[model samples]
Target chain A: AQRVTQPEKLLSVFKGAPVELKCNYSYSGSPELFWYVQYSRQRLQLLLRHISRESIKGFTADLNKGETSFHLKKPFAQEEDSAMYYCAPPDSWGKLQFGAGTQVVVTP
Target chain B: EAGVTQSPTHLIKTRGQQATLRCSPISGHTSVYWYQQALGLGLQFLLWYDEGEERNRGNFPPRFSGRQFPNYSSELNVNALELEDSTLYLCASSLGVGSNQPQHFGDGTRLSIL
Candidate 1:
């Protein structure tokens, strides 16, 4: 079984402050990690994936096997960045396990 | 192309009643996935369908079942509904099964069991 954990239920940061949303997972095999974001009144969508190894909208997440973590990070936060963030395993295997999600509230 | 779509944006049912939800995958996509977002449970995989076949299912019971059609559309049926069964059922689609392609989600069908 695959499980994902997002320790924080709500995360708040002021404008221009660096932010990080923590995520951890447990899987026996090589894990496929992804970060999805849901903006206000918008459907959920991919923010950035570990395999892609690229930043999206100033957000990036690194998959660490040793620590079993894939924490999302942003150099500077903006008010528009407020949304729900989910860490998940691959949807292909039907596990698609997602963390409880972190509600990010970026304040100006 | 249009993103994934789900029918019956909202539904209401009573205990022991059954509910059916539908989904249409994106053009050129052949995979559809069902997930449930309860009040506190977060998002959970319910089932996966690809090419008109049941490729996989989550830890749900037999009461939660679904099938796929040749057009890549899908249906999810929940029987013996309980109050806890009320939730937002989301449908997602990708190119196919076992790929790295990100799943595109629908707005979701909100089911309320009384």
Candidate 2:
């Protein structure tokens, strides 16, 4: 069974500190990984994808197939970056499965 | 263009009652996917409809069903709702053209079962 695992339920970091949210996926085929974020009182939106290789909101994720991981990273966390981040399943024809999200709280 | 839209942002129902949630995909999107976002469950794909047909479905009971119309609008019906059925039901839409087009989401409908 294909699954995406977000090991951290809540990750706390001080403002201006670096943040990394870990994600691991189990899939046999070439996987297309994505990071989705939901800010408070807002709809869930796509942050970035492995294929695009573009960084959004100062966050970037690299797909490491050998390690079966696609970890989201931000060099400097901002207070506004506090939000719920969800990692999606491997690319498929239809909707992608999601892992239990990780909530990041940036404190002063 | 407007994003995916869901109706009745908040709903309250009792046990044994049925709940119907509606979703309108983006103007050109041909695929609609329904997901249940419950506490600690993340997001569970419920159903996927494309070209007015049920293409894929998650592991859910028969009581959970839905269909897509010619306009690509979709609805999810939860029958005999239980307390555990309380969740945020989200609807997302994708172009269904090329692969890897990320699904755009709407602010989900929050269903509260008592």
Candidate 3:
């Protein structure tokens, strides 16, 4: 069985501090993971994908195959970064298996 | 291009009533995905459609059904709605299965079951 777990339900951080959201998955094959963000009253949007290995909005996530984790990280948390983040891993048919999601709060 | 779009921003229904949600994928996208986002429970995959065919379905009851049109648009139908069915229904589109493209989402439809 495949499952995604996000250990933290809520994370509060001060502006300019670093923020990290942990995501661990259990899958049989090579996994393709993604980070999606949903802002207040806004639609969910793709933040970054492990395949791309790129950063978006000062956020980046690296897929660690050995540890089976894809942790999203940001050097400096901004007020705008406060939102709900979901880690998604796709099944064979391309259906996304989303984590429980982590709510990040960056206070100024 | 316009992003994936879903209709009926808000819908209210009584128990046992059926609800149908619509979605129009972005142009050139041939895959559509449906998800349910309930309070506390993050996004849950409901269905996946590609090229007007049902590719896969999530761990949902048969009462939760949907179909995709030739134009790549899709509709999700939930029968015998219950209070637990009150949630945000999200629609997303992608280039196609195995394309490794990021799915684009739309402003979800809020469904309230009383």
Question: Candidate 2, which CAPRI tier?
Answer: medium
| Span of 10 residues, lowest total lDDT, candidate 3 chain A | A25-34
lDDT of 3 by residue, B1-114 (tens): 999999999999999999999999999999999999987899888999999999988899999999999999999999999998999999999999873577999999999998
List model 2 lDDT by residue over A1-108, tens digit each.
Answer: 678889999999999999999998877365567889999989989998878775579899978888889899999999999999999855454357788999999999
Q: lDDT tens string, model 1, B1-114?
A: 898899899999999999999999899989898999876667888998888989888889899999998888999999999998888999999888654667889999999998
* iRMSD, per candidate, in listed order: 2.5, 2.2, 1.7
| Per-residue alpha-carbon lDDT of candidate 2 for residues B54-89, written as tens digits (9 for 90 to 100) | 988898999999999999999999999999889899
Off by over 4 Å in 1: A28-32, A91-95
Candidate 3 chain B worst ten-residue window by lDDT: B94-103
Candidate 2 error regions (>4 Å): A91-94, B97-99
Cand. 2 TM to true fold: 0.94
Give the total clashing residue pairs for model 1. Answer: 0
Residue-level lDDT of model 1, residues A5-108, one tens digit each, is 89999999999999999998776354556788989878888788666664479898877889888899998999999999998765336335679999999999
